[model samples]
Target: MRSLEIHGIDDLRVVDRDDPAPGPGEVQIAVEWGGICGSDLAYWRRGVSGTAVMSHPFVLGHEVSGRVSALGAGVSGPGVGSPVTVHPARTTGPLPERLRGRENLHPDLTYLGSAAGDPHTDGAFAQTITVRADQVVPLPAGLDTRRAVLAEPLGVAMHAVTRAGDLTGAHVLVSGCGPVGLLVVLAARDAGAARISAVDLSSPARERALALGADEALESAADMSEEITVAFEASGAPASLDGILRHIARASVVVQVGNLPPTPISVTLGPIVSQELEYRGTYRFASEIEDATRLLARTPRAEQVITHVLDLEDAHAAFTTAATDPASSKVVLRLS
Candidate 1:
């Protein structure tokens, strides 16, 4: 099988590797498509995603779709050749009272393509890869591999929206119009947000946000009214934080979904204290993936966010395009 592996910073390459077989309770999938996420580019560029250092050469994908090629001895239900999207997460330690219902908050968990720990969890960036059967989610009817590849990130967006609490008829603001931010717009609209506004430095990203669901997309908050009742900080840019705090209405909910670097930045904290605002932090996702699969199956327009699909042989090009092209949203790599 052909696999796209990252050896070090700026050293990603396509290498031939032996096919992996399913172990007990695991399933082997013939991957068809994988989305290029921001973290994936981080690994290619810096050999690390946050504190997750690249200890070894590993596959570089998590947002993937494939067909079940074989099942482990204990699993039997979703027979071979079934199309599926994977949840890509597994809890690895005893649950704590503080993290009972929120599994994604578990301190000890592993995700595909992440090098956050030693003997890092491998991901589905190959023509064939094996994963635990529990992570394999059979696709909902009419959801093809191409679009279903979005379920992972869409789940992240859904979870971020979940953190914002009820949006019923609430005016929402989303800063930064990256793929996840754009998906936040879609999810906010689905949650009955009265009006959705988005801000981004990139005009192309703003356009994509508007196409997804934002009532208006702005280059900045200069023209935005100070009426936003709920705000989501999805840009991860320090400057974007300043704008979000300046424009949101008094007593609004602000959910930070994007992963900011460990470094601290200076942002106006007066807004939070003076306006009596609520600021919440959100991580990856929990059980929202199931909902994401159903939503993707039901909404065809969601596929419009995928702007480019390149062949696996062009994996480097795919990463480059995903990182450099502001006009592109979700750039995917076709594996099989």
Candidate 2:
């Protein structure tokens, strides 16, 4: 099978590797589409993602859609040739009682393509790969790989909204209009946010936020509402915190979705203290991928979030575009 691997910083290779048969309780998939994520771009550009440095080469994808090619022993359902999307997380062990419902918060939890751990879990940007059967989810009747590829990132967006408690009839603010932030607008609307506004430095990104669902998109937080009921900061820019906090209403919630630098940067905490704001940090999703898949199946608007689809051979261009081009929301690689 052909796999796209990061040899080192700024070194991306589309090399051929062995594709082994699935072991027990595993499912082998022939990848159809793989979305380039911010992390993927980070790995290619710097050989690091947050605190995880890519000490060795590994496949670079987690947002993928494909067809099941083979099921291992004792794995029956989601039969051969079934179109599916994968939930990329794998908990290393049983969750403690305190973390029962929140499987994603497990300390030992790992994800595909993440270099956070020693063995560096491999990702799924290849022609063929195998993963645990439990990680696979069959696509709904009307969904196809093109749209299904968004389930992972959409899951991230949906989970952020879930962290905001309830947004029913609330005026929501989204800081950052990148792919995930754009999806957050949809998630907020789905949760009954009466009005949604987004802010981004990029004019194209702001425009995209409005096209998707945000009632308003601003280039800066200067003109934003001071009555924001909830704010989801998705830019991962530490500097963005100050701007977002300035407009967030008293006692409102702010969910931080983007992965900030491992080292802390200075930010004013007076809003949290003076206004009694509930500042929450949301991590990667738990089971929301299921909801995301179902939502994508029902709505045509979600598909518009994908901006570019490039062939696997054009991965260099894909990663570069995704990293540098604000006009490109989500860039996908066609594997087959």
Candidate 3:
């Protein structure tokens, strides 16, 4: 079997590895497409994402979809040949009261391709990878694998919208038009938002957002003259987050979906205090993978967001395209 490994910053290679067999309660998948996420780019460019730094070689992929090639003992649901997408986070430790129903908040969670652990957990970017059966979600009937690969990021967007509560007939603003930000636009539209506006420095991203469903696409939130009923911060920049806070209407909600750095950021809290604004932070996701799959099945335009695809052997070029190509939205690699 072949696996993509990131030995260090700007060091990625395709290496031979022993094929993994499924263990009890796990399933082996013939990995098909794996999307390169922003975090993956961060790791490739700097060997770190937020506070998590790579201390050893790591496999860098989490948004993946594939077909079941073999099943482990005691796994009964998804039979062989079933097409599926994976929920890459595995939680450990007892759940706290607030996190009991929300497993995404589990104090100790091990995520695939993450540097959070000392010995990084391998990710699904190989010819074949084994994962717990419980983490796999079957793709909807006839859903294209390319689009199905988006379920992970779409799930993140859905979870952000879920944190925003109901957006029905409300003006919504999405800061950052990256892959997740663009999907946030689609999610907001699907949730019955009256108007969907997006902000990003990339013209191509803003164009893509408009093509999907955004009513307006601005270069930055500072360009917006009107206040939004709800705002989604997906740029992970202090300036973008500050801009969103300035443009949101009083008593509105703001959901931070982007992964900000561990460092503290200074921002005005006068509006939040005086207006009684509701600010929330959203992590990976809870149970929105299924919803994201269903949403993708219904959204044909959503597929346009995938701008580039490459073979697994070209993983280095794939990472470069994803990290440097301003026109690229989602860059995926075909493993098999």
Candidate 4:
């Protein structure tokens, strides 16, 4: 089998590797479609940041959909040749904190494509990948592989929207018009948000956001109206962060779904204390992949989020395009 490995910063090589057999409780997926996530590009361009970095040569993909080629012992449910999307999360049952529905707070959680733990369980940027059977989410018939590849990122947006509480009839503002941010718009619209506004610096992305269900799109975050009751900060830009704080109505909820590096930025904490705003931090898909998948499957124009596709051999070109191209929303590697 051949796998694309990121040796270090800006170093990606397609190299030969041994085919992995499904271990007990695992399922091997013949990689069909691999979505190029922003994090993947970060790994390629900057090596590592936030929580994910390459310490050794390893595969780099998490948003994946494929057919079941083989199953490990004790794995049932979906048989071989079944089309499926995967929730690339690894966790040991429920921790004390997680048992209370706070699984994201698991004390010893490690993510796929991370430098920590076994770097051997390579990701889906290859001919095949073996994940825990439980991590796999078998999609129903008629879900195209290109659209199914978006399940992971959509899950992130779905979880963030649900966690941000009710948005029905609320004026919502989503900052950042990237894949996740655009998904946030879709989710918010599905949740019955009214007057949803998407903010981004890219004009083309703003247009895409409008098409995705944003009532209005703006290039300047500071120009956002002060009537926004919920502000989703998906752009890691410091200016966007400050703008969200200023634009959000009093007593509104501000969900930080974007992973922003620690930077010295000033904000008015007096409003948070006096007006009582909700500032929440959300991670990737955790316990809500199933719900997110259902939402994505039912949502109209879900496939429009995917803007480009390439063969597995063009993974390098896809990565480069994602890093430099704002017009490309979701880039997928079609393995089949």
Candidate 5:
């Protein structure tokens, strides 16, 4: 089998390696589509994202859909050739004190393709990879592989919307037009939001936001609606956060969904205090994959979210294009 690994900062190598076999309660998947995420771009460009660094060779993909190739002992739900999506959460033991019911809160939690483990428990950027059977969620019937690849990112969007509570009848502002941000727009609309506004620096992203059902799309936060009652900041850019804080209505809820680089923002504490605004941070889905899948199944434009597909052998090019080209919405590397 062939495996692609990140040897160091900005170093990607495709090498022949032993095929992975499933352990008990695990299953081996023949990766069909692996979507490149924004975090993956951060890893490739800077060799680090958040607090994790690529200190050793690591596999760098997580948003993936595949068919069951083999099953490890004790796994029975999906048989060979079943379409599935990887949930991407690897836990150590029982959830920690601060992480109870919050599996993702454990500092030791390992996300597939993240620099959180030694040699990084291989990811979906290859032909064959094994993961716990429980981590495999069967794709909904009629869901295309490209759309199925959105399970993970959609999970994040779902988490963001969940953080804001009921969005029905509220004016929502999603402060990013990336895959995750666009998904937020879809999630809000599905939740019956009265209005959806998407903001991003990329024109293509803004256009996609509108096409995905946002009532308004802007290239920047300037002149945005002051009536936005709920905001999801998925851009991670400091300016975006500032804009979100500036435009949200009094008593509005703001969920910081994007991983911003370590930069300070000019947040007005007055409104947060005087208006009793609710501010929260949303992480990757802890145990929400099931619900995310159901929601995606209901979305009318689920398949249109994917913009490009590439062979797994073209991982480098795929990563490069995602980084340099704003037109590629969701770039997936197909292995089979």
Candidate 6:
């Protein structure tokens, strides 16, 4: 089997590895496509994402889709040859009674391709990999593998919209037109938002956001005159957070979906006090992977978000392109 591993800053390589076999309650997948996420780019460029630095060589991919090649002892349906996408997060053990339903909050959660854990867990960007059967979500009938690769990030967008609550007919603003930000535009529209506005420095991203159903797209949030009712900050930049607070309508809710820098930064609280604004933080999703698959099946335009695809052997070039190319939205690596 072949695996993509990150050795250090700006260092990536394809190396040979032993093929993994599925254990009880697991299944082995023949990986088809793996999408390059912003976090993945961060790790490749700087060997860290936010505060999670890589202490060892790490395999870097999580947004992946493939077909089941083999099933383990206890795993049944989603049989061999079934197409599926994976939910990357896995809990180390059973959650406490109080946190049973919210597995994302478990203290021992480990996510594929993440450097947050020591002796980093390997990811799915390989020829074949094994994962727990329960983490696999069957793709909707006729869903293309190119689009199905988006399920993970789209699920992040879905979870952000779910956090926004009752967007019915509301004017929504999405700050940052990156992949997740643009997907948030689609999710907000599907959630019944009356108007959607997107902000990003990249013209291509803003254009794609409009094409995906945003009513307005701007280079920066500072240009906004109307007060937005809800805002999703997907840029992870301090300026984005400040702009949202300054422009959003009184009593509006803001959801922080982007991974911000770990260092402390100053922010104004006048909006929170005088305007009674509500700010919330959202982590990885719980059950939205299924919703993402269904959403992609119906929204053909969502495919526009994917701008580049490369072979697994070209892993170094893939990460470089994703990190430096503003025109690129989602860069996927073809494994099969």
Q: List the residue pairs that clash in candidate 2.
A: none
Runs in model 6 with CA error above 4 Å?
97-100, 225-227
lDDT of 2 by residue, 1-336 (tens): 999998898898999999869999999999999999989988888888988999998889999999999999999979999999999999887899998778889988889999999879899999998999999989998899899999999999999999999899999889998889988988889889999989999988888888888999888776778768788999998778777776677888989999888887988778888889888999889999999988889877888789999999999999989998878999999998
lDDT of each prediction vs. the true structure?
Answer: 0.88, 0.90, 0.90, 0.81, 0.82, 0.90
Query: What clash count goes with each model?
Result: 0, 0, 0, 0, 0, 0
What is the alpha-carbon RMSD of candidate 6 to the true structure? 1.3
Q: What is the TM-score of each predicted model, taking all chains together?
A: 0.97, 0.98, 0.96, 0.94, 0.94, 0.97
Model 2: residues >4 Å from true position, as ranges? none
Model 4 spans with C-alpha error above 4 angstroms: 116-121, 266-270
Evaluated against the true structure, the overall lDDT of model 2 is: 0.90
Q: Check candidate 3 and list the clashing pairs.
A: none
Worst 10 residues of 5 by lDDT: 262-271
Tens-digit per-residue lDDT, 1-336, candidate 1:
999988899888899999998999999999999999989999998887977889898888899998999999999858899999998888876879988779997887899999887887778889999888888888899898898999999999999999999999888989988889988888888888999999998888888888887899888865667778888899898778777887778888889988788777888889999989899999889888888888889888899889999999998888889888878889999999
Higher lDDT: candidate 5 or 6?
6
Q: Quick one: ranking by lDDT, best first?
A: 6, 2, 3, 1, 5, 4
> Residue 226, candidate 6: how far off, in angstroms?
3.1
Write the number of the candidate with greater TM-score, choosing between 1 and 5.
1
Output the better candidate (1/4) by lDDT: 1
Best by TM-score: 2
Clashing pairs in 6: none
Candidate 6 to truth, TM:
0.97
Better of 2 and 4 by TM-score: 2
The residue-by-residue lDDT of candidate 3 on 97-150, one tens digit each, is 966668888888888899988889888888899988889999987687889999
